[model samples]
Target: MTTSLRSTLDFLLYDWLQAESVTSRERFVDHSRDTFDAVLDICERIAREKYAPFNRTVDTQEPHFDGEKVTLPQCTHDAQKAYAASGMLSAAQDYDIGGMQLPYTVEAAANSFFAAASVSIGSGLLTVGNANLLMVHGTELQKKVFALNEFSGRFSGTMCLSEPQAGSSLSDVATRAVPDGEGFEADPLGPRYRLKGNKMWISAGEHELTDNIIHLVLAKIPGPDGKLVPGTKGISLFIVPKKLVDTEGNLTGVRNDVALAGLNHKLGWRGTTNTLLNFGEGKYPVGGEAGAVGYLVGQPGKGLHCMFHMMNEARIGVGMAATMLGLAGYYASLDYARNRPQGRPVQGPKAAAGAAPAVVKDAAQPQVRIIEHADVKRMLLAQKAYGEGALALNLYCARLVDEMHTGEAALADDARMLLEVLTPIAKSWPSEWCLEANSLAIQIHGGYGYTRDFPVEQYWRDNRLNMIHEGTHGIQAMDLLGRKVLMEGGRGLTLLASRINATIERAIQVPALAAHANALGAALQQVGAATKAAWATGQPADALANAVPYMQAFGHTVLAWIWLDVASAALASDADQAQPSTAGRMGAMRYFFHYELPKIGAWLQVVSSRDDTCAAFPEESF
Candidate 1:
């Protein structure tokens, strides 16, 4: 039997898991269809039956900390255990690491399900994955002493970069790491130095969830003149464990100098514990002959680059989580619209009393389901376009990662450069747009969305955290303009433009997509011209002032191109059972071109504008 258009679209986009194929650019995610289906099936079942059931409970019963210990809901613990037991925690690792060896694309797709189910629970695994990335990059001794033991449940890990004084700017960080004795005294196991400073907004900072916490801390080391080095250059990474371990990696009791000063009560993501940590108190090790116990991860002065190993992965993960929550909101809204009947359509007049209704008893009524309303459909379509397109983008990036590792030298280099350039966009655009989808989902539910009665509100709250997750929208914009696009002589931007041009050329050949292709091509040219002009001006600040518009314009153009590509592929599929599915895809493509593609003109206009409007207003003027 032929499925509905929505169902067919979902199956083709996600179920087939076509984004993981890396052997050929055109044949990405082409193998193991059955394995992909099984994984997705498991995800859906776990999400519906296990994770979704406790979301409300977990949100209401946020993790609480007593003087001695922190307590979390049992369901959250159980869910984490279930996730680990299911082998999902190691899904992207090699088969030797007790992993299923699933491709990064598949892992990313599956993560969306987990995040949508429970963002808080999902966060723990993300931290673990980030730690795993460090393990891959760190020295063998570091991995064996810290990483391996942590993966085996002896220690849990957390990334510590933000301090009370330095939130986003690392150069302003004041944390100090001084050598003392054989090791230091602040170490919980004794023999480590004193780590004296305050760290803020640390996720999974203090929890009874794990035996010990491995904090990947960043601190400044003294330079040549006995003065702290300026900027990230002087900063170094330390694998500071909550409990001290011996040479054999055996864990000892008590805690390190790090103490949870307070907990942050956030507007969203209450399920994950956020803490303010004070490292090195008088009682612990500061001024006590010993310094904070620490082992450097890599060479001093290269900490930021090493941390990027984790940060890049975290950025991609943030986008995936945001997209998932958006998808959840969309599906929930769709379900509600299907079930909830509302007011009559404006086109039809009121029914006369005692007269037979114009509509049949079982037929469509003048007052149709909310899903049928034009405005509601608009919101739903917007959500679909953003969520699905972002999903495709992430998977596409993941495939690029694989290509970078396993493809030929030229292909690998191209993939690496392209992925690096798109990283900020892949992270920021979805984080922003998918959140918009969540907001629309709430609006779709009207008043019910504002209350706890529906999941849409929670989805919005969870997704809200993603804006600040890996990096803020402004930070991403700066990276895109100041660094990624402009650095290396604008090679990244040029490469991306060439790819978009290829898509446009191919799309123009398809009669169904010719208009969208033409419109997108014109917008691309406008963006390219503006970008070149900004670069020529040599005023990075002025150039970056228009970065956000470039991001949006380019994001939309790429998504339009991807939709066209999808439509082209669907049109060429076998006509047997895929015909109806292809027809639905064609309809969506038509809708996108008509409703969504037209906005490219406005985005282009904004991108091409000078920075005069923004520069005109001074800080005091605001």
Candidate 2:
């Protein structure tokens, strides 16, 4: 809850995004800027009071599981409770479901405080996302029994997608679900089924933080041939609870066959329990059966579609986590720079060339704060650019989510198209560059930064996971180039370019941002050209061989657009010119334009040429 963070959030929310305008919508009629401020105030206070102080405690004291149950520190428990009590878990849900009916944009802004304070202690990302999906796809009873309870915080939720064998390839998933018995269809819950399989890398898979854990699992139902259907087409979603619960949502005192096989010992996020879960292992069978009882969600073979509702939300959540972690490191390093005095500026005295009439060489000079050094400022500016630019980018996407849900039909459709193009970048860009921000944070701390004695090292380790989770960098790359940009007859990409061009036009009117705007216009053109050239052959292998590089180039271009837009907005709003908030944003924007935006050339080069040097390498040559 640094004042710096709060101010940045304020500027982004009210000034740049014009979040207050969203309250005019009928869905958000209950909310006002005052109410939004109160929510943010409470969130900042709770995060500072309960989460910030115990960040180190949770990191050092990992979750442990005894023979019978898993255990976590009391601080983690208290923090989770405090966050749930804030009514943010269902912030965007309807008022009927215990939600305050807050706008998603404000919800994302409020959640950032907790993420910055401590990401590993849990942020209700999965719980909220899971409930949101059920609200869309689940039946009436399912919504009442699971989604509502989750929103109330009586039951926490998780999305179980990856298997040990499948990993990110949902097409290769092998988890199987079968009808429970003769009366399975007539059972009060949707279509009752029995599931038996192993799910890997389940976060918060087994925890006592709530009354029960509701798992939204992806599995394939067997065909009449008694064989599991092949590929993602066969995939279907199921709701499998940790403890058997009735339609009224009361625990039946009988446990489902889902068992925690073991915990993953990770380098970071030690506070969360990432586990290998064994379903239907006979260890906790229900009613003289070994298979875990699950209720079907949506139609058979439509599980991936339903599960995507949660996956996409989690991807955005991961992006915000990465952005906040990077900001956390930036804040830490910025504080150190302000307080730690070590060096004298070299510009103090310039002796005449070859002149002996100068001050004594041994004269003692006072050491100045590290902030006095230009190189240190470079590092700080880089962090600020990446971290703050990413914050704006993510919040912009959140704002789009609001528009998509609450805006008129045409505006909502356009928002959807823009989201399809931006989601991967929003998720992957921060994951990669923000981790670099973390690295620079450590560099600013010097040798002590890498040690456990400093918190920057831990921020680096925690952020390293963002690139691999939700979706891998490579997976997102393929999604961006292989699918997203080309979806809907390339309308999504065109919609995005139109928006970027709109920002460019606005910024061109501002003299300070004119050059940056022109530079961004060129970058966007390069991205567009590379995209067309990559697909010139109309072959997946040729186009996708350089997908990662293309994604890198595309993400940088989008960020450049975001920076120019922010700068343009600040100038338009007539912000106090002398304020550090305004001046620092200009500086960070300048840094990105001069130092970072040019690197996209090399990335787009390989992309446009469809370079296959790596793809063609022989296995033994490595």
Candidate 2: which stretches are off by over 4 Å?
A: 347-363
Candidate 2 lands at a TM-score of 0.97
Error of 2 at 17 (Å): 0.6
Candidate 2 residue-wise lDDT, 195-239, digit = tens: 999999999999899999999999999899989887889999999
Put down candidate 1 lDDT per residue, 1-622, tens digits, no spaces.
Answer: 0112225335544533354344244333334656765776676566666687888888889888786567989887777666655666666555555556566666666666677777766534545555575666676666667666565554678888889888989898777876655534333322233456778888888887666788888888776676789888888777777776765677765456677787899877888888988776543553343344566667777778778887888888888888778888888888888888887665444579987656424335555789878899888888877777777777778877877876789988888888888899788878888999999999999999999999999989888988896788888878877788776777777788887788778778877778878987877777677667656667776677777776776677667766766666665563333566566556666676778767766655655665557766789888
- Cα lDDT for residue 38, candidate 1: 73
lDDT of each: 0.72, 0.92
Who wins the lDDT comparison? 2
* Candidate 1 ranges beyond 4 A from true positions: 1-31, 123-125, 152-154, 182-194, 282-291, 348-366, 574-584
